[model samples]
Target: MKIKSVNLETVCGITSKMPENDKLEVAFAGRSNVGKSTLINGLMNRKSLARTSSQPGKTQTVNFYNINDLLYFVDLPGYGYAKVSQQTVEKWGKMINRYLDGSKVLRLIFLLVDIRHKPNQNDLQMYEWCTHYGFNPIIIATKADKIKRSQKAKQIKQIKETLQVVEGTPVIPYSSMTKEGREEIWEYIDMVYEG
Candidate 1:
């Protein structure tokens, strides 16, 4: 995954049509405030291109980043924000589902969870929904830098148990600030496409 070029090539709103892309697609799915934009920026080796925000629910649309013209990094709308209205949340859910159902080039989905706490109900539901859509989402535990080194194993175990992920599924702990676990993620991505 040598990122020779990266471009924010597509932005799909609630009613916008998903591009009929010809490259492999990988999606990132997670709750709002999960540091998704930061992770994406790190992966692209660029700062603030994905638009990190102080407010939750800031990314209200699906963003597609063309990566090296070989793959598409799909940033799905963040879910499970408390301040959003029920109607708006429902629409976001539908929009995500629609993209998952419609994309023909989609190869994998990475579901991010905050590492400081056990998986919540929304996280569980999202995990289940990803499975229901025929995806074995690779879980990325975000905010790894916020926790103590001694707590890392325990928290990762708790997250896996709470999500009830199948045996052998990946659960990676990632830190945007330290850029830890970035190479492991890139290796996994490259393997999935190259192998």
Candidate 2:
């Protein structure tokens, strides 16, 4: 999974249609401020290709990043932002649902959660939605560098329990700053692609 080239191929807004991509698609879903953009940038090995911002809920569209022209890293809009209006949130939700229902190449979803906190209601809902769509999402515990190494296992356990993930499901603790767990993630992606 060595990334030789990365392109922001498509940006699907609330009223826009998703591209009928010919390549495999893996999506990233999580709550606002959960470091979705950071993780995407880290995974892509780029600084600002995914557009990280100081404000939460800045990602308002489904960004399709073409990875080495082989697969797509689908960046779904972050959910559960309080500052956003209810209508806007609903629109975002509908847009995500449309993609989930409409995408034919979507293979896996990497659900992100903050390592420093328990999975919230929104997080649980997102996990449920992924499962409901018949996708067994791989949990990525972001901000792992913010916690102590000793606390990593405990936090991962908490996330699994809170999300009620199926047994043996991987909950990887990842750090965008240190790039911890990046290789594991790419390995899993390769496994998914191969399997």
Candidate 3:
């Protein structure tokens, strides 16, 4: 799908604040600093479209971006930030859960993971949650450029093992810095939109 136009429509703190339109929505969810924003910007072929940040847990709200007036790219707040209090994390969890369970138009979920590290407990939990809720999750392993080409397979295997992803589900290795896996990611998006 060609991205003719992309614009931030709204920053929603709760599900009620989400855009009123019933466009197809694909959400991005992952741990803090997993390069969710960067991947979005890369996929749109625009710089700073999703507001990349150096600090983890900077995105504190569910941001909806209107794409070509046909679909919505929901940028969810990252989880597993240690600096924040337990209460704040619990509150964010509630908000995210509400949006995930309540959104009728949410078709696909892209779960981002830092390729340099193994999938943590938070990542596994999120994957399980998606499965339990009946959402199709496409695992995106970001920062692939940081690793050597020969080691890519090993890393992918480790990630799959750690995350316990089942067969047939895609686990794409991506690099926002190099724009790697951009086409593959878009292809996944196209398949979702077409389906």
Candidate 4:
């Protein structure tokens, strides 16, 4: 799980075709402004390789990061941004769906949700879509550092129950600020990729 080399390998827009990559691919999906970029930056041990902005929906394209040429960390475009029009959202949806249906080496999908709030309609729908795609997504509750230590279990339980995840799904609480749960996430990834 040591990151020896990382590159912003490819950027696929709505019309762009997904790379026919030979390496295993892991993807991240979440609502707009849910710290996906921050998580990616934390995982890569980089400051801003995956652009992080205060604004939501900044990532409009599917970004593929090459991790030591071992695998591709695919960042799907963020969903559920209110500022954009419905047509734009639909385009993003179709683009995401295309990647999900088309990628051959896609191994796992990590669905991110905010730890402080109940998953909204978009979150529920995304979870359902991931399941429908035949992926048992590992949920990552982001911004864990914002919550109190005592509230961790309750929040995690709420996430699991709200998503109604299948048994044995791992929901790791992550914080970009404290970098807590980063190692656990990497360990889980290693187990899945190397076990």
The best-first sequence of candidates by lDDT reads 4, 2, 1, 3
Residue by residue across 2-67, what tens digits does model 4's lDDT show?
Answer: 899999999999899889998889999999888999999899999899877566775579999999
Model 4, CA-based lDDT: 0.89
Tens-digit lDDT track of model 1 for 1-195: 678999999999988999999998999988888889889999999988887757778567999999998899999888788888988888888898898888898888899999998888888988888888888899999999999999999998998899999888888999988888899899878976784
lDDT of 3: 0.84
User: Model 1, stretches more than 4 Å misplaced?
Assistant: none
Clashing pairs in 2: none
Candidate 3 TM-score versus the reference = 0.93
Query: Which candidate, 3 or 4, would have the higher TM-score against the true structure?
Result: 4
Q: For residues 9-95, write the lDDT of model 3, one tens digit per residue.
A: 988874446566578888999988888888988888788878776777755788899899888899888989889887778777777
RMSD of each: 1.1, 1.2, 1.5, 1.2
Residue 81 local lDDT, model 4: 86
Judge candidate 1 at residue 152 and give its lDDT.
Answer: 92
Candidate 2, 1-195: lDDT as tens digits: 788999999998888989999999999999888898889988888888887756677558999999998899999998888898888878877898899989999999999999999999888888888888898899999999999999988999999999999889999989877888999999988875676
Output the lDDT of residue 95, model 4: 91
- Regions of model 4 farther than 4 Å from truth: none
Worst 10 residues of 4 by lDDT: 51-60
